[model samples]
Target: MTRTDIASRTIAAPVARVWAALVDPVALTVWLPPEGMSGRFDRYDASPGGSYRLVLTYADASAAPGKTTADSDVVEARFVDVVPGDRVVQAVDFVSDDPAQAGTMTMTWQVTAVEPGTRVVFRADDVPPGISAADHADGMNSSLAQLAAYLEA
Candidate 1:
């Protein structure tokens, strides 16, 4: 099996609160986008087998062209599973003309109740070749940091 990209953070909040941020579309939109970007979901459903289309826009696209357009990248994803406070699994694909970026990436987020808070572990399986490892890692870490702040605030 190909090794997955992993990022984790221990948030200063309970499992239930942290879980809420993961499944709530409103909360997700606030925190899911990495630094230097913002996002909006065209449609979102958190239930098992539900699907969503999210468009993430860079603050300054001239620096980094998006996969779907000059300024925005679309993410088409389906919820593979939602285990409430435990885990949320999704199959994700980028809407991009670039063949190197075309593939279903399995994103698994697992949560564990820790001493001071909830430990959120994010794993990205089958990451598309077009995305560099460093870039993906930074994105994951950025999102995790945002998640922590969103919950602790």
Candidate 2:
């Protein structure tokens, strides 16, 4: 059975701005990671079929363990679809020895214009069994809040 999680938030920003946050590598690095974590993009190509590598490091070294090596989680991802100002779909795989976390998971981000702002929806499909749904939802919500803050600044 495939596990899925979805989270949505209304940001006080335009759709274009939200889309920029999704596609721009620098913007993504600034707002993508959850609280207490930092992200760095090794490579980023926004077009369909383009791939990227990102490393996420925890603020506390002790927090790493089974999730990743030492203090960082490395993710290799490819863009499956990109619809400007609308949606983005990507496939992601974590670099880990644990078999439960070894498969490709698809994530989709949808942006819609709403009154006075934009609504952003984050959906993850075929999530690894090793990941907790509550934690994933919280992280996604945190990321969304960070995105809103980034755009507001």
Candidate 3:
């Protein structure tokens, strides 16, 4: 089997709460980023064949119209499996015009209850050739940290 891009985090909240943050669109926007990032859900039906779009926003004084800032990128995804509060499998796609620049990767989030907290494991497969795996790893870690902080708040 091919190795996947994986990241895991332990959240100091119950499995149900952490799971809510992962699957609930309203809750997801609360902690999608460490910086000025937020997501909006369009058709967030969490089930096989269900599609959703997450719009990420950032403040960019220097950016031109229809351009993303250095701090934000919007990722639209469709769920492959909706495992309630335990696991969620989805295919994440970065919205872009170029086919070579555009591709889809599968993201799986697993939540396990571990005493006064929940362990969330995230795995992304089929990373495009041009993307940096390490960069994604760093970003994912930061995002999870942000999620944990939001949960605590």
Candidate 4:
């Protein structure tokens, strides 16, 4: 059975700033990659029915090989819904030959105004079995932390 992973963090920024970062492709490349990984975007179109391609490279691929290549994990994602300053929902698929990692995962990033900050909630549904629960949680948390830092700094 497929799984779902959810992570949340409060960012020390207004919802507008956080939302801008969430929708901007360049901002994503800066803070979306988890710890120990860096990412690049081949193409990006942020809107309903639009899509983007992201390639994430590991710092040390020898330790944790990638699904798309020896050192990279490529992703093709479509924006299902984009609500400014509110939420973004996407359908994400990994570019990999391995069946275990094959499938469209629904990703939702939701934001709500909080005292002196914004609460960002990230949810991944229908996660492929190839991704471990522990790793997914860590990655999501890492991304959230990075987002906070990018906006706060």
Task: Tell me how candidate 2 scores on lDDT.
Answer: 0.91
**Cα misplacement distance, residue 67 of candidate 3 (Å):** 8.2
Which digits, one per residue and each the tens of the lDDT, describe model 4 over residues 1-153?
769899999998999999999999889999999989999999999989999999999999998899999999999999999999999999999999999999999999999999989999999999999998999999999999999989999
Highest lDDT: give the candidate number: 4
Per-model lDDT: 0.94, 0.91, 0.73, 0.96
Candidate 2 Cα RMSD after full superposition onto the native fold (Å): 1.1
Better of 2 and 4 by TM-score: 4
CA shift of 4, model 4, Å? 1.0
List where candidate 2 sits over 4 angstroms from the true fold.
Answer: 64-66
TM-score of 3: 0.81
Residue 123 lDDT in model 3? 88
Query: Could you give the C-alpha RMSD of every candidate to the true structure, in order shown?
Result: 1.0, 1.1, 3.3, 0.6
User: Per-residue lDDT for 1-153 in model 3, tens only?
Assistant: 323788888889998888888877777777764354455766677768888877676555244121233444567788888888889999888765545336778888899998669998988888755456676687678778888897877
Error of 4 at 55 (Å): 0.6
| Candidate 2 residue-wise lDDT, 1-153, digit = tens | 999999999989899889999999999999999988999999999999999999999888675453668888899999999999899999999999888788899999999999989999999999999888888888899999999999988
Ranking by TM-score: 4, 1, 2, 3
Once fitted onto the true fold, the runs of candidate 1 whose alpha carbons sit more than 4 angstroms away are 1-3
- Estimate the TM-score of every prediction: 0.97, 0.96, 0.81, 0.98
- Using alpha carbons, what is the TM-score of model 1? 0.97
**Sort order, lDDT high to low:** 4, 1, 2, 3
